[model samples]
Target chain A: SQQGEEDPQALSIQEGENATMNCSYKTSINNLQWYRQNSGRGLVHLILIRSNEREKHSGRLRVTLDTSKKSSSLLITASRAADTASYFCATEHDTSGSRLTFGEGTQLTVNP
Target chain B: DAGITQSPRYKITETGRQVTLMCHQTWSHSYMFWYRQDLGHGLRLIYYSAAADITDKGEVPDGYVVSRSKTENFPLTLESATRSQTSVYFCASSETGNTIYFGEGSWLTVV
Candidate 1:
């Protein structure tokens, strides 16, 4: 119920399994981005999906956006133990100027 | 060195002290931002600047201050640090509508 809200606050799965994270927003956005953070370090950009785009993929990552629903999902295929990290979804809404609002994030654990 | 860098990577200060965190970027991107990361809250934007001398507040800008005197430097200051302000601060920059990059982070503690 916020600008960017991600669910499944914590997730654990076996290596090679698929990990999916979902995000929802309350307003129209220009673009939505996914970021990964390991431990407590800085965040690393993973991918970005524009409001007009419905699906995008990069290597093992896949992101889908549905503007009508104002929601997005990120899927990591064949997950690896090194993929363990917190994933966050951020949105740059139409009225947010040049900044983005981030959600609480999903802590993913890939057990090898 | 190349990307974004934050100074005073770790800091400890009293409750009422004024603390400033310095941010510098080498890419000279036009958009810069300050965000505070907490345990349950994730990353909350504090301040941002589109260009020099033009700054705006973000989602949580209560006690934080920001000024972009130059294109490469954006600094955030806590006028009066509070225990609630103790969190990891991150500085980021991007070319308008592009991928944003983040600094390592500044771990601050207020006692």
Candidate 2:
């Protein structure tokens, strides 16, 4: 079974707009990571926020984690046409040995 | 520099035939993983290895076999291919407690 489920299976927005995607997980985790996958390509690591950290930022990407809610959110500000891709949230369970369990993912389209 | 590479970028094989996908990394990362991506299923892990000679199953491990004889290489094999196994397969390597680096992926079709 997948450990996490991402909300808003798909999203579309105009360029320069903001896009947010949420993910909910079933169990506790040591850390959560976000990845981007362009069509017909493999996934690329975006960012990782440890369980102890509430938020993290990387350029236009912002990530927030709420341990109590067992959920996290990825925010992309000033989205561009190149930002169109599938975003996934992966959870690293404390018990697992660095094996990340991924969610279904959210497909985001940035219209130019 | 080749960070990670998967062989036979694309493959097409008949059902019931055995097929193998190769993955090689130059970083010598301690952990290696194999995942299959389907339309609605996202990326489901098939197997992972922490180091050479240590292998473990992931979320979707049925009909798949993985071996890590060397830290730089991990290969996934399908003993008997089935139509349902057609998908894009990816290989990744990572250091403990760090980000993972994925290969371009190998597209396989079981006809």
Compare the candidates by TM-score and give the number of the best one.
2
Lowest lDDT 10-residue stretch of candidate 2 chain A: A93-102
What are the DockQ scores of the candidates, in order? Answer: 0.67, 0.71
lDDT of 2 by residue, B60-97 (tens): 89999999999999999999999999999999999888
Best by DockQ: 2
Tell me, by lDDT, which candidate is best: 2
Instruction: Give the per-residue lDDT digits (tens) of candidate 1, residues B10-95.
Output: 99999999999999999989999999998756898899998999998888899988999999999999999999999999999997
lDDT of 1 at A4: 80
TM-score, candidate 2, is 0.97
Could you tell me every candidate's TM-score relative to the true structure? 0.96, 0.97
True-structure lDDT of candidate 1: 0.92
lDDT of 2 by residue, A24-109 (tens): 99888989999999988889999999999999999999999999999999999999999999999999996545889999899999
